[model samples]
Target chain A: MKTKVYNKQAFIALQSILVKEITRYFRIWIQTLLPPAITMTLYFVIFGQLIGSRVGLMEGVSYMEYITPGIIMMSVITNSYSNVASSFYSAKFQRNVEELLVAPVPTLFILLGYVFGGVSRGMITGVIVTLVASQFVELQINNWAIVCFVVILTSMMFATAGLVNAVFAKSFDDISIIPTFVLTPLTYLGGVFYSIKMLPEFWQNVSLANPVLYMVNAFRYGFLGVSDIPIENAIALIIFFIVGLFSIAYYLLAKGIGIRS
Target chain B: MKNKAIAISDLKKTYSNGFEALKGISFEVAEGDFIALLGPNGAGKSTTIGVICSLVNKTAGSVSVFGHSIDQHLEAAKRCIGLVPQEFNFSQFETCQQIVVNQAGYYGVPRHIALERAEVVLKQLDLWDKKDSQARMLSGGMKRRLMIARALMHEPKILILDEPTAGVDIEIRRTMWTFLRELNEQGTTIVLTTHYLEEAEQLCRNIAIIDHGTIVENTSMKDLLSRLDIETFILDVDSVPNELPKLENVEYRIRDESTIEIDVPKEKALNQVFESLTEKGIRVLSMRNKSNRLEELFVQLTERAQVVDREQKNEN
Candidate 1:
């Protein structure tokens, strides 16, 4: 009976955190949801329509179709990462994270609450970007299960990474530095617009070292049934990252890093 | 004997910067007791509160709430405590109702129950009309009341408020006192820290004075006030006497044409002062304590503690 009551309370705490996070982004829709849709639409219009006409049939499919999954995955990664990082950091700046810190709620619940909130935003943005992509080209799903699993897992991994970043962040500038210097460069080089197979031998090996590359290839494989890396390898790597990042994020929270005195 | 609501044993905290905020202070609060944990600035009152709430890591020693050790049973211990921190810590963008309800949720209250509790607390704090307004839009006093409301939503057994009325106006502070008094009367254990010595004296049955990172005095309010050797009283007179009346063991100073301050020792009766004033033909219109009784003892105890600390330092 005691464990049951504890579980029930834990569930409510998780729900509260998740609802607050979702309401925050939805309350400022123009900033959180709209920007990603507009940016992805621009990518679809320029890279898939204007530039694709000149370079076609690189992956045995239309250029617009090949880049669709990558564009959608890109939205998921960036949105997931930014959603948790900005929300958690703002909570710290406002000194409101003490709400959870002082509560009876388990640390795991708090960590999962923020992670799932980020995943929710990421998945929602992914859907919005997909809808925009459909306006420019028709999307075909080669495997629905794989597509769902990869996108959700990739979002969870990035969200947990965002949490770790928020844990260490001391100022607004600290939160932005990681997204600008690390996320942006890695996303651009992660084969969002072109295939890694098109690169030289040495560069292909180096591209393999980028974690985002595996996420993009796995998502693309789910949609187009083609990938530079094996489907098994991509799924394994994504799971590996989710576990690793989740552990780090949980450890930081339990230790009260940057949040507690 | 009343059960202990909180037991902190040899609690110590040293910040990462090598500053020792708590130097093994030990104290216990009984169930249903309204106690004041008084301390000067940086005297470890806030750090001690932080450690009990698990917001600050204690370097050594132990804290237990309602028999649950903080280290071994943190969640169980936390469930008993509702903390209204010294600062406004809620999100500025969140509505008053949302803030209160969410705090309940964090403590595992169901949404419907939390919503109902939010209404009750908001109304109790006189924040019902501003329930939908964002937190930042509230005035300083209203924000503090909102924090109190939020802390009370879960109905915890122990409510710990750190400087809950630091900058509040007297009227609002009195109203809050009434509310907190009602809470204590209903059997809730309240541990409060406030710089307002009068507030502490009025509301708390017990008092603990900390200074130089140590517990210098811990006694009941009645007993502690009895330790005051002398009390200064300000008297308003109809006219000043040309020659002040001299009394045994009493000193007097004229402030203005119609006012005089008198230091009355514990053995002297106030009626004796009144009789002497009548004999002197100095018509006393009003009289009040020049400083709060607790304030006087607090200063004496803290000052003595400082002297002891200096002596130890010299010895070292």
Candidate 2:
């Protein structure tokens, strides 16, 4: 169906866009790749060793192991969202989005190219964070499919959201606003360090409202076979959000909301 | 009928802030035509080019490239066009080779083909030695050439250059003109927008001049140039004439003892002036136009458009 929608030119155009996006961050790995690895390392040390030890067992597993999936998911979400948000905003700022707009590339391919760039960064950083976590915790992989599915889907979801943020963003400060005020708080409160069961009933209901909770818990379920919500429900939520966010991103692009004018 | 390289019918664009940049403009470029789209600043030249490339959304009307409607067959329409925008839109961090190769890839050129094409175009543009250098490291003239190189990599049927030599040095500008002339000779349809009337005069066969978001003139270059009523020419004489001889319907002003400027009407004959000058024993050494004809015409049209604007405002 994708091929039917896009001819050979569009396909090649997509590849070119993807290659450019990939090379951009890779060329500056110290800025894009290294920062997250170092930050996640500090998180593992400070939260898992210093504070997580006193916090003790969560769901009958060691605190470090219980929070491992959540921390990794956090990095994936942040990196995926930030990569696209910053990259796309910078393109808009420099007016080079015109290059993509003027090309024969389909709108879907353009969106996919940028989203995949975010996904690539998210997955790479996710892997590095996972490796960092493995050093401190006896990690177990209960369902690899669910792990891969959840990881990819979460990255896609956040990447799409970041694109939407970029479409509406007018300045560099605007790009950072959502990630700081909304993303950071939602991610931290998404049951990363502790399970929602530790919260009172009212707060647990509040935590359930956060979409990121579904992603982190789904990822945690893949690794430990334990989850607050049904695995099927978490999986469905992730898919639903991915579809919804992708549609929104496509609509914004088609309408030429911010970039075209 | 021959295929049109570009066709725009009633194209319109109004920004979200209520700025009407293009107000229902329409024109066409035939295949292989080197046409100049000339206008003063803010006369919607860039907006028109932007709409053709899909960089700006059109509020109404339609555009087609080689029979492919931009609205329905945008990809096909875009495949036929290579646009060099007025600004440096490529990433400053990208190398010249990367920028050009990446542009070729956008048009569906394979990686190897894009690489070869990049080398060829860069070399042709005298930019091969700086291929690996970042774009920001290049001089302004080199940056402008780099944009042209990138645009030509895919070899689109139509190339739209918006002020390709705005701030370039005269030498580089002449080199670019020569290069563009050769490209035009190879049957590439070029539609350029520039403030330099001399560029339009030198390189274009047809021209469409816009003023206040409307086309005031669109015709063949020869037809446009023929519309001038009088042309001023400076004559260098071999002898210093104490008194200048004037012919009927010809106005002459002596610049120096041996140099004189004369305004020759379109209906006047040059031989009459030569006869009169020869009678005075003032032998002519050389003669040339006192100013660029196109520049004079452009100033007249823009000034006339401003008068109309003033009258409309007064009526309002």
Candidate 3:
């Protein structure tokens, strides 16, 4: 049996790919990162500061603080998701991806490279939104570890989701469809503004089915020490979702599902 | 001398849609060997390269490089190979140096070493001056050279080029050919796939002609040429020939009443024909031999597949 030595090259490949992904969006930072920050800022101003004043407290916390973490998580998820999805799809569209595909790097590393790139951008945008939200909601972190962990996990989840989308996407419109039709709706109704406690019993069960509800409330709990579901359960659910997403992503990549060949 | 840098045996690929892209390809390329994969479109040329590069999955087969099995040692096999693709398929937003160096990193070279190799390859390919320019800003020829430089940065033992100079300008094509020949002399086993038969004739020592997803012919260039059996020699006499050259194993046609077109079995003694013309006190003119090379072989193989297709359709 022959043994292969340690592959330091995989890490370098990962870093370079991450840089390429980062610069791709940063090169057009005004369009890619800045617009989202500005848009999220407006949401905080209009919905949280301006609108929350009239609505008052839901779940006993100020509307401004309740929506802050959810909004930050949302931006992180979407940005990370969109970054990898569009970048990978663009590589496919331009036929440039053949270079990497033809290289000897492990498929897992390639996936990580693109995912980290998206995740990095997502985190950067999320931090920016969080800072802006701090001014409006007077944010607090009940558990710094949970806040950071959820942010990173959510970034990974969405990054993998984005790549899967890119692989299945045949054209430009294919990527945006899920984001517009599916992602936006689930998010808007995922307890971003109001808690599930306000809902009747039947509707409350239905809301529990939305995974984003767990993620948002879990993230919100990290900030204000309150959540719709148990904090410990939310952590378990996020980890469960991460492993499930990671396995599916790995299997899809290894099988070259929509991509291999 | 190096025990066959690349040894491929019984490689096959069947698409999910039931199309057999490759029907058990088998070949061996020695160190410093320049082999040309010649065929028309969809003849499994790309599929063969894809399998060796580990991009295209094979339905059934085996391949080895540097005595290492591909399945068990993909990274090791890949580390020994470099692929230069046909299309200008790179991150266009990055500069030329970035593309080459980034590719080197994928192979696990340290950053400084990768940079040094990048500089050397770029200079060799006449791309040093354009190092700062992004791929989108460069001309088609420069972009092709950039791709070549990127592939060379890692210094792999086997270099596979898929139509590296397909649509470039004449000057650039000639430059690329010269650079490749230099690399070949330095002991890199080059596997080139191209539409240009003349390139194969000029560069490759061994040739494989594939058609309809199967290997039609594989042999030394000398053997393939010899087997062709026909050569047209153009002899320009100082004066118009009143009659054609009366010689055995040859045919002639008067051209402008000065040049005579001579067709003969390449093995026939052309010296006898020459002596007869000299004995006739005919002033010798310039002569040109039209050896039927890979061009004829490629045309024959591609056309034969087409005929087969036609017959199959007719029977159906």
In order, the TM-score of chain B in each prediction is 0.97, 0.91, 0.86
Error of 1 at B30 (Å): 0.3
Worst 10 residues of 2 chain B by lDDT: B238-247
Per-residue lDDT of candidate 1, residues A132-241 (tens digit) = 98898888999999999999999999999999999999899998999999998898899988899899999999999999999999999889999999999999999999
Q: Which 10 consecutive positions of candidate 1 chain B have the poorest summed lDDT?
A: B291-300
TM-score for candidate 3, residues paired by index: 0.91
B257-285 in candidate 1: lDDT tens per residue?
99999999999999999999999998998
Candidate 2 regions exceeding 4 Å error are A1-4, B234-247, B252-261, B267-288
lDDT of 2 at A171: 90
- CAPRI rating of model 3: medium
Off by over 4 Å in 3: A1-6, B233-247, B253-262, B267-292, B301-316
TM-scores (chain A) of the candidates: 0.97, 0.96, 0.94
Better of 1 and 2 by TM-score: 1
DockQ score for candidate 2: 0.72
Q: Tell how far residue B196 is off in model 2, in angstroms.
A: 1.2
Q: What lDDT would each prediction earn against the true structure?
A: 0.93, 0.91, 0.84
Number of the predicted model whose lDDT against the real structure is largest? 1
Measured with C-alpha atoms, the lDDT of residue B205 in candidate 3 is 92
Pairs with backbone N, CA or C atoms under 3 Å apart (clashes), candidate 3: none
Ranking by lDDT: 1, 2, 3
Q: Pick by DockQ: which candidate is best?
A: 1
